[model samples]
Target: MTEEFLVAKDLRKRFGDVPAVDGVSFTIRRQEIFGLLGPNGAGKTTIIRMLSTTLEPDAGGIEIGGRSVAEDSVGVRALIGVCPQELALYPELSARDNLVFFGRMAGLGSRQAKEAAAENLELVGLLDRAKDAVRKFSGGMKRRVNLAAALMSRPHLLFLDEPTVGIDPQSRNHIFETILRLRSEGMSVLYTTHYMEEADRLCSRIGVIDHGRLISLGTPAELKSAIGPPDEVTLEQVFLNLTGRNLRD
Candidate 1:
């Protein structure tokens, strides 16, 4: 397999007169965790949408596993699993049912869907609560189920958008461990989050986006070193220095 699992070139997207993504480009390699860090309205979400084949770019191009996103969206979708920032779950359904439903949506057979649901639930430490209604579960528990649903596709690349947002420390740590384990198992991940420390700990490389453009790209150590002494510099410091402290809408 090629080292590069995902590639985008000069991607540009405009909504009306506003350019949401302006000439953004990056690549995610096999078994690598690539972080995309930006404040609100940085266009990372637009980038993710284009990468995941949910939204077509008005300009530029994208290829995942050598298949062009515009020409082969079906093929691209088969190789990717997207865990969106928003919860995509049937809250009234049991956790097991929710996963099974998503598995079926991913094109698994009924038997395969059930089996995958059980496996994913176990993977997320939610097997014991599989039959519980999702509405009764805590936010952390629901987020775990969301991750499990995304895995039903058995994808080669995963798009995780703010996966640990608003979760407890235990849930966040569980997610961190899960992402690391997936990478070790050869899954390429495109991760986006507002948490600089999380990116610092988990990403092999990080690309910082601001005002709809890629402003910086490097390993966490390199990025820190760019701002100050590596050991003395924090990712948050680097982020603030690059993006400034102004509040984003």
Candidate 2:
């Protein structure tokens, strides 16, 4: 078995008095697509932020590739790519330019960054639109560019938070294909989404979190088996069974 690419032990984060991430723990193996499946406000984003090193955990530990996030944050940042829930793009800049800017910021030299930017844009099927200003692109196109930017560094571990949000079916499918291809090429992914179907389709294993705690962790089949699946089993059914039907809002 491949070694774990990411590990979180007793991860805890609080917002003033309320706990946002309450002692959640999980491990993601190398080259696997691991899903952080939960509903809105389920602390999915909070866990993601802490794992990405954008936010420090109040209590607990995070290790990526056996390096402590607290002790080697810069090294951790160098080894991972993050595509956040919100679009991070320069509206006035063309897609190619935006990617080049981000790549350079990630420590690549100018010419090398531009080349990498072009390659990533091609991977996302956006090479033809590389010269188009982001402000003029459709929402789906912009999201694709955002993804390309994150991959400019060719990181070993990629963090994608709600990458399919506001995207068309075609774009979503394309993104899913790209994710699988990356995993096949030995890139580990920590995918965060409220979309149950996406998790069912892409994840090698799923970790279900609700109220800042992980409630279930297993392969799709393992999870279904645990709950005693009927003939027609789905991730939605498994999720509802574990988290219940009450509205989080």
Candidate 3:
């Protein structure tokens, strides 16, 4: 097997008496988007938090680029980028300014920050609107800027948590294209989303989580094949089969 770019082993986390992530383990290889699929409160964000070093796992461990999260969290942080589910942009700031500010915060010098901001804006197809205030942009445009900000660090791996949520179809497709292009350029991605088609289209491998546990892991084709006859099953069907069709609060 190829050496893993990121690895989570037996990860466990809890909030008071409730377990949020339990014994979840997975590995992401280079140049692939790994999808995390689940319903609301299925520990998807919790896992991303632990991997991104926002929260320490109550049990288990994570490693990035062969460095353990406990021993070399700073190193791990240096190699990863995170675009959160919520907008992490400054509404009053211009898109260029937002990206530059975040770039500097990620440890870039002023010149480097500015250059990276420009490059990422181009990458997300937002260079033309770089000077507009975030609040004046549409939802899709804001999301583009949010994603561009994360790339300021030039991270080898990126975590995208519901990056297309609440955006129009046009913007959603734009984000999808950007992700594919990133993978082509050798960026590994850990993508979490509730959209089955998104997982089916973007991810080389999909992990289904429910009740704080990883219930299944495989390529979309492999997963779909497992829960149905021949090639007839969809990722959505496989997910509902493994996680059940019941509503989750």
Query: Can you give the TM-score per candidate against the true fold?
Result: 0.98, 0.97, 0.98
Q: Give the TM-score of candidate 1.
A: 0.98
User: Which candidate's TM-score is highest?
Assistant: 1
Show model 3 residue runs off by greater than 4 Å: none
List, residue by residue over 87-158, the lDDT tens digit for candidate 1: 889999999999999889889999999999999898888999999999999999888998988999999999
Q: What is every candidate's alpha-carbon RMSD to the true fold?
A: 0.7, 1.3, 1.2
lDDT of 2 by residue, 153-246 (tens): 8898999999999889999999999999888998999998878889989998999999999999999888888767634788889999999999
Report the Cα lDDT for candidate 2.
0.91
Judge candidate 1 at residue 135 and give its lDDT: 95
RMSD, candidate 1, Å: 0.7
| Candidate 3 lDDT over residue span 121-141, tens digit each | 999999999898999999889
Error at 67, model 3, angstroms = 1.1
C-alpha root-mean-square deviation, candidate 3: 1.2
| Clash pairs (backbone) in predicted model 3 | none
